[model samples]
Target: MLRNSKSGYGWIAITFHWTMALLIIGMLSLGLYMHQLPQTEPATFQLFQLHKSIGFVVLTLAVLRLFWRLINPSPRLPDGMPPLEKAAAHLGHAGLYALIFALPVTGWFMVSASPWGIPTILFNVLPVPHLHVPAALGSQEEAESFFKLLHEYGAYLLIALITVHVAAALKHHFISRDDTLNRMISAAPGKTDN
Candidate 1:
């Protein structure tokens, strides 16, 4: 199933959800791990490059996933939910989506604004150029510091949001006893319902 149905997610959405989940979680873990390592080590530099590569990949995937969501309808929230709860759910989801895009863009901006002039070679293969910043942003140092803070704090926000998302899903599945989680994990056999 390529498109989403009224009841459940299609293959594409499910794939995007799981793949991006893994990548985002992995990226967050990597970031925390790298923070503890001595920056002068060669391995630390390599890890930073790898982190940048994954950030770009996440950005690309986020673009596609968002496009898909724009075109396809998402599975509806449980019918029994209260109006206030539903609104909260929607707002929470909005936050999640916002972080998804903001984190990567901020990371890219941070790297581009760095004074070191380090070229971002994606996966050490493809050369990703830095963003050409106008003088209006002041010195590169200030801009880099600004974006770096955004990226770092954005990561922490993402983690907190993900916790809420997962808890809500589990609540829907276990407490609510609905097919909410199941529908996302797998569609009914021969089901066109996304």
Candidate 2:
């Protein structure tokens, strides 16, 4: 059995991790910039549509990652980790999972409520159906508007959480001199779900 630390991250896990990270960075930057634009602007609508489409892809990938984790289980942290560090690691991971799942959900709900409707962007060549929500509370506009706010704020929270996560990883890798960073990067060949 190859040692976990020296094994390195499975190709799939590394692929997913890097790809999702890059995508999130793009989505967050674009989403924030696009939000600053006037709602009445034609480009604003298209920007939002692109954001929603990307969000859906992120959501799908998150679900698959969760499923992969459940099936394959993550490698254990380096032995003899301090209690506090372990706890922090746990919290960081949990927060990541929460944000990953929450982001797309909020986005989806907002798109559903959006009167303009969401557009699919498959390789920038497809238009997927807008997942619409049922009218129940009052006017569709009012509901969608409310959900849009939730989605927007949720994005900010996600960005903050990601910032914290990356900082912690750096701390572990450099300041603490711990295996925390290595563990994620060295999960054995083919063990990664990404």
Candidate 3:
């Protein structure tokens, strides 16, 4: 039950999916809240640190999840699904994974290029290295602005993808009455294709 089956997802896949989903949602909300605070507020710094810490955690998890996914292939789509639908599912998953990697990296670059030059002490415990951005590219302000825009727009794209992902899952479960959602929720070994 730990490995994926042709018919359904296993415990590991389900755990990774749900855990990352929850963390991403939390990170998005936190990012929005932190963005609204004035730079001078003491709480703003604390929140930014928390956001960066969690972003690093998400980045690590995303790498692990992608590795696991490569080793364990996803469950096959239910029979009778249109070819277009299957293709859309694949594209949606790819987009999500890309965003998962991108959002954190952009955030890290944004911090590294910060005009303030503040160190990122993750969770107030361990120090994380800042990414090296070449001085020749532009001013620190310019680099920060570029990465900040990327990070923000990337998050919005992620939100849009998540909405489509959820709606599709609901459609599969309710409209199609398929095992797509059930496979993720249940640990029971699915029926094997002979």
Q: Write down the TM-score of every candidate.
A: 0.94, 0.80, 0.96
- Model 2 C-alpha lDDT per residue in residues 74-171, reported as the tens digit of each score: 66655667889778878877878888888787666666676765455755776666565767745768878877787778777777878888998898
**TM-score: which is higher, 1 or 3?**
3
In model 3, which regions exceed 4 Å deviation?
Answer: 190-194
lDDT of 1 by residue, 55-167 (tens): 99999999999999999987777778899989989999899889989998898888899998889999989998788766777899999988888988999999999999999
User: How well is each residue in 62-168 modelled by candidate 3, as lDDT tens digits?
Assistant: 99999999999778888899999999999999999999999999999999999899999989999999999978759999999999999999999999999999999
Residue pairs in collision within model 3: none
RMSD of 1: 2.1
For candidate 1, give the lDDT of residue 92: 92
Best by TM-score: 3
Clashing pairs in 1: 5-194, 8-194, 9-194
Residue-level lDDT for 10 in candidate 3: 81
C-alpha RMSD in Å of predicted model 2 compared with the true structure: 4.4
**Distance from true location, Cα of 163 in model 1, Å:** 0.7
TM-score of 3: 0.96
Evaluated against the true structure, the overall lDDT of model 1 is 0.88
Alpha-carbon local distance difference test for all models: 0.88, 0.72, 0.91
